[model samples]
Target: MDKLLITRGVQRSPFWKFILWILPWAMLLAWGLYGAYLCLAEGLNQTNMDNRFAFGLWIYLDLTVIAFGAGAFFTGFLLYILKRHELKSVINSAVVLGLICYSGAIVVLMVDVGQPLRAWFTFWHPNVHSMLTEVTFCLTLYLTVLILEYAPIVMKNRQIRKVPSYLVFEFNLHKLMVVFAGVGAFLSFFHQGSLGGLYGVLRGRPFAFREDLGIWPSTFFLFVLSAMAAGPSFVLLTTWLVEKLSKKRLVKRETMSYLGKLSGVMLIIYILFKSVDTLIWINSTSPSSGFPAFEYYDRAAFGTWVLFAEVVLFGLLPALVLLRKKLRERMVWLIPSAVFVLAGVALNRFVLTIQTLALPTLVFDEFLSYMPSWQEVATFSMVIAYGVLLYSLSFRYLHLFPQERELTQPY
Candidate 1:
């Protein structure tokens, strides 16, 4: 079965070894499913959320993965639109990663919504004034685009492509890929910005509220830039990890360096704008609302260090490292820089989702903190396990890396 399913000329681990490798992830997935089941069967009571702290770990996960998943649309934009042909080496992998991340985010959101059965209300009764409505529409539409983009890859499998109909279908799908890529990028741009705008429009939460840049707040554009910056780095990191685990050269050194360079250039742009946004908020936005911006960081846990880490340490440091040609070429430096960029994105999401909810908004309100229940942690772990399992299966069966055969074989 493995032999028939595996792509021709691509080396995969023995069937038994492969089974052993996936066993843990499979178990983790099952455990996570059980946790999700409990949440659905029981209710919102299963988690530690309440009226004041409606957003929790699950919301954070949704935002973070969606940001990381930006690789799919951004990579497609680079390859199909910009004519950066070198990106072909990792485009399929990017699509798969995008599918996993976006789908996982939707699943988590379903659970977080509490009334999963009534989730369609967003579409049935739309709210034209809400950023969430835009986010909902764009996320669903972009996910559909990712699925369509991924179809050709799935159809190109060893046994699947043998069928004449499937072969023709894949060939035709290949022709329409650029259109899907364009649509996906368009959808992703709106949703990513809307997610940030969701926080920025929270007038009740001065820590999150920002002055409108025209109609949208500063966070709106900032989120888009951050996602674009983080996307390629995530793709590069995942590709490197796959290479290490499989003990194979999946892509060329130049491809990896190119991804790093792209990420660095975007990161620098994002950081510059982000710094300006922060300064504006501190000097004008928060103060105008009668809340001192620095006072928001007076809490011991949510201190000034978090801002420093997000902006300077994770943000500026990684951008500098990846922009340097010599440093990005080295695996040690490149990998850590990618990690930092991702961390910066995650930290930004955390501050927006968790810290915003945790802080006191009213004059007499006390500082509050909330932690995830076991159910939340398990459900979160489920998404990671799901991504690993899916990527492993895709790598074993699909031609994710175009350069693999040439890099490994003697011509």
Candidate 2:
């Protein structure tokens, strides 16, 4: 029964093995759901987050996953809008990844908002001037665009394609893909920037604040560029992991190399701007906000070394590694570099979210160190389990990797 449902041209692990693997993940999902129920029933006191940290693990994870998910819209823009034919190989996988990232974020956000039922309030009673209002609008619209984009891919599954309507619907969807891709890219651009601006607008927290680049803060563009940099690298990393786990090649070396090159170039651009932005904040923005920037760093927690680690160790190193032909072509080297690129982005999100909140705003206030409760960790683990479960099922039943057939000729 399971074999019949699997994609026709590809081989999969035995049914029992697949079942065994998902059991733990299913348990994790249950745990996460229980944790969410607690948060909703017992209220915000269940978590460690207080007035100081209104946004906790849920928000941090949301920011990180969505940023990493940029590969979807960016890849779509390349394949459909910019006319980059090489990205066709990974477009399906990229879309699925984006769907997972965006949907999971929405779920976790429901927990973060305190009253899950009130989520509709953002839409019904809109605040036009708030940065969060802008984020809500773009995020919802872009997520819809992603669903429209990936729906046809699900219809492409062998069992689903048996229906004539599914086939015809999928075909028609392909024609308007350019429109969907354009909308998704435009929406993604604004929300990605607004997320950064969410903190930038916080004048009280000079550590998180940035100078306005015209109307938007410098952090706005930085967020967009950083997301684009991580997007392709995350795709490369996931493809590599799938190949390793399934023991079958899925994409060509040249295709992976192209992604690596693009990722590297974008990282370089982000780093250049980020470095300059950091210098400017240290020199001008912090001072203009009526604070001595170096005074914020007069403690052990957020030292000057943190900035160097963010820029040099993770940023410049991976950029160079991905750009080097000899380095990127080697699986041993390229895989770790891709991991570093993703880690760097994760670190950046952590700094912006946690560290920014941890710092004190007043002269007499003490710096803070946040530790998530068991509930928080469990909920976050649920996000990872959700990704594993969905990706497992999708890869088993659907044709996520279009080149899987050609690449695994021996299978």
Candidate 3:
């Protein structure tokens, strides 16, 4: 009876319907896999990325997803450390999402690197001063933290729980979850911050350069703050999408509202710091490097609009929208506002990656534009498909939502 009931807990769709739902995503995933093959077999030449733009769409996606994915650690911290009991209702979903985001970013990084087979040379050669090394180290360690945090959820599956030893193991692991969450928080703080530091440390790229605050650049903290601001917003949007697709209330509206409010406050704080950082970069940092601020904007490839789009459209608009009580209460306003927050982060990534490369550092340097080849897009799309597929499977197999059985009482 327990096994039977457990099977029932897994969502049931007609086989044809499941096929229909997954077919398009599956095709896209396959195309991405083919792209991955080309990347591996043919080499890095397959993409538009070059020596100047070594960190292209893949790096942008990795950082943006990981930054947004910080909700996993932050949510875990709230539930396990701070004892915000309300978050327990949605913690599992956060962990699953984090797993997808972090793991997927790692996978993409593996493919994005040249000589992926020799990737370990990063650790072996160890440019200790390089921000990328810190990113690599912390990211991998934090991924372990995420896996550990997620293991108990997998173990809670009725079939798994039925095994007595596994039950005890999971229970023990759950007891130690706070430790794992703490480790995740620690690792997340550094890497998310360091991802921004990656751009900030580029003294050559004045567009990305920032005035140093002690040893770290201002963008370091700004990145972490921006990530925290955007992280919960992404979670809210993802949960809303899941609810729409599944046609069920996964998380209560109150919880969603709380997350939005938190995001709004953080967004405002981040924008303030960002504004300061941008001003400092333009006035003190860029000019010192003998580059005019507006000179970074290319007439053909990048216009001044990128600046307004990132700061105003992506930054202020969503921050203002989500911050308001009346706006947040209205689902119509809130959902798109969360989307704008997402767009802002994505735009942030684009400017950091593409714009940095587009600007000519030397007078002799030529203007450059890069469109991610189909290979790059396909591989990137695979990350989304994989996340969707994993999240779908997790939702079906695990008790992702505590509210599900309570609200629906699936019997």
CA lDDT, every prediction?
Answer: 0.94, 0.90, 0.84
Candidate 3, which ten residues in sequence have the lowest lDDT sum? 1-10
Number of clashing residue pairs in every model? 0, 0, 0
State the displacement of the C-alpha of residue 271, model 1, in Å, after optimal TM-score superposition. Answer: 0.4
Candidate 1 clashing pairs? none
User: Could you tell me how far off, in angstroms, the CA of residue 353 lies in candidate 1 after the best superposition?
Assistant: 0.7
Q: What C-alpha lDDT does candidate 2 achieve relative to the native structure?
A: 0.90
Off by over 4 Å in 3: 1-12, 409-411
Candidate 2 TM-score over all chains jointly: 0.98
- Candidate 2 RMSD to the real structure: 1.3
Error of 1 at 263 (Å): 0.6
Q: For each candidate, what TM-score against the reference?
A: 0.99, 0.98, 0.94
Order by lDDT, highest first: 1, 2, 3
Model 1, poorest ten-residue lDDT window? Answer: 111-120
Window of ten residues with lowest summed lDDT in model 2 = 296-305
* Tens digits of per-residue lDDT for model 1, 1-411: 889999888899999999999999999999999989899989988999989899999999999999999999999999998989999999999999999999999999898886788988999999989999999999999989998888899999989999989989999988888899899989999999999999999998999998899999989999999999999999999999999999999999999999999999999999999999999999999999899899999999999999999999999999999999999999999999999999999999999999999899888898888989999999999999999999999999999998999999958
